[model samples]
Target: MIRNTILLAAGAAALFLSGCGEPRAYGKVDKTPYEIRECNKELYRGIDTDPEKHIDKIVVHKKKRELAMYKKGKLIYACKVSLGKNGDKGDKVQAGDYRTPEGSYRIVRKKCDPRLYKSLMISYPNAEDKARARANGVKPGGYITIHGQPKWNADGHADRFTLAHDWTEGCMAVSNKAIDALWIAVKNGVKIDIYP
Candidate 1:
């Protein structure tokens, strides 16, 4: 009888701990992965071909939800993107909310987002972000990146690029395909300027 009670307790504990989505706790997530081929296909569809393909600089505008790729001084590619809501301000992203940040950043690491389709991790809330946040009265939250969509959400699946209002938690969001291309076009240490 004692053994049975212990087993039941353990089982119950395991059940209670398991949350929706992945095993990630309420506020802990490292990376999420999804198929790259589809993402790549979707990203190129909307890209402007008029611009040449020698990417030298990239800029993401949160308010505009637009990404501009430049080679030297000439524009090579321009694609619509999704940014944060409430207008990107200082650093420190709110939990489960949508709002892209505005600042200069770099692609530190490239990883697959298991939760989203795919993602290119952008280093946000850097020293400057923290400093500004500290100077202000708000906290400088972390976990900012350029990623794709989460799993199993079909509402906006058809029109990922057309939606308005910044809708990311202090992270820039582009189509999975765009990110995949970015993974190849935009190299590490490339400067990405995100603006409001």
Candidate 2:
């Protein structure tokens, strides 16, 4: 009887360890068909809309859901933002962990997508992120970005309901209209600071 009890305990321990071994994957990329629309120039009439306005910094307050733009140490614009679904807990630590990273990063790349609206690549899993993941014996995921909503259907319509929620895997999300402005306002190599 003692031998059987020991075997059962060993099996339970193995199950528990396996459960704790890896992070679960979250979020899905939408691939529905979409088309770009010509934005109304009048939509961005007020304030300084010039790319030369010298806006060079982005600060994201994850808990507060705020994204503020700065130019030469002055506030240029501010808007609401949505972070990863699991972002409230802490900075992302491994692949498949649905938490946005917190730290200083740069806009490494930019790509225009009809389905996803627009995307600004963030340099996640930097040296420090990699180090943390290495220490934990896990892979640090990549492909993090600041992007707009996806086209949900063939009509090129965006799901406004989804846009109003925090649902990304590990990226910053903004409205398509807001991304339009950001696309022109933000330049590559601009510094982005994400705070918890």
Candidate 3:
């Protein structure tokens, strides 16, 4: 009787160790591999392009969701961007409208330290924007910028995540690596055109 009991116990232990062949999972599974999850650290950390070169202008195509950097009328760099959450509604006319303003502006300032990774402030309320806002009796939202990934995005592994949807309040957002390059290459007072 003791020998039979021992054998039965051993069989039960073996079945338990087999774990029904496959483990069970619940909810959404994150399939991003470890390497891609930490991609921001592994990608675009070096200066493969000309380090001494500088950009003169920036053009943002809202419809295309792209930002292009140019030097002396020649295209040098272009990157995907996330625009205002309500950008499809049209140009911004009032504060909190959540639309990217259309027309020309200047990069008035560069913030090395910002809530985001980095940023170049844009002069959003150009005379035209202000006039239009005033005529409509609404405030022209300001503090617009072309900036890098948010703090949550860190090195920018989440950039693709951001690019998949329009997420900015009204700013143009790029990857942290792209901002690092822009921070070094773009100077204050550079002209930028935001197009619908």
Q: Which candidate should be chosen as best, given TM-score against the real structure?
A: 3
Clashing pairs in 2: none
Q: In order, what lDDT does every prediction score? A: 0.56, 0.69, 0.70
Please, what's the RMSD in Å of model 2?
Answer: 13.2
Q: In model 1, where is the ten-residue run with the lowest total lDDT?
A: 14-23
- In the range 1-196, model 3's lDDT, one tens digit per residue, is 9996875466444322321111234355332322322333323553322447778888999999999999889998999988787877899898888788889999887653324555678988899999999999999978788777654456554455567667677788788777767777776678999999
- Rank order by lDDT, top first? 3, 2, 1
Top-down TM-score ranking = 3, 2, 1
Give a tens-digit lDDT track for model 2, residues 82-174: 777777879999877878899999988766454455678888879999999999999998878887765442232333444455667778877
RMSD of each: 11.4, 13.2, 16.2
**Over the full model, what C-alpha lDDT does candidate 2 score relative to the true structure?**
0.69
- Record all residue pairs in model 3 with backbone atoms less than 3 Å apart, i.e. clashing: none
Which segments of candidate 3 are over 4 A away from where they belong?
1-51
Task: Flag regions of model 2 displaced more than 4 Å.
Answer: 1-50, 153-160
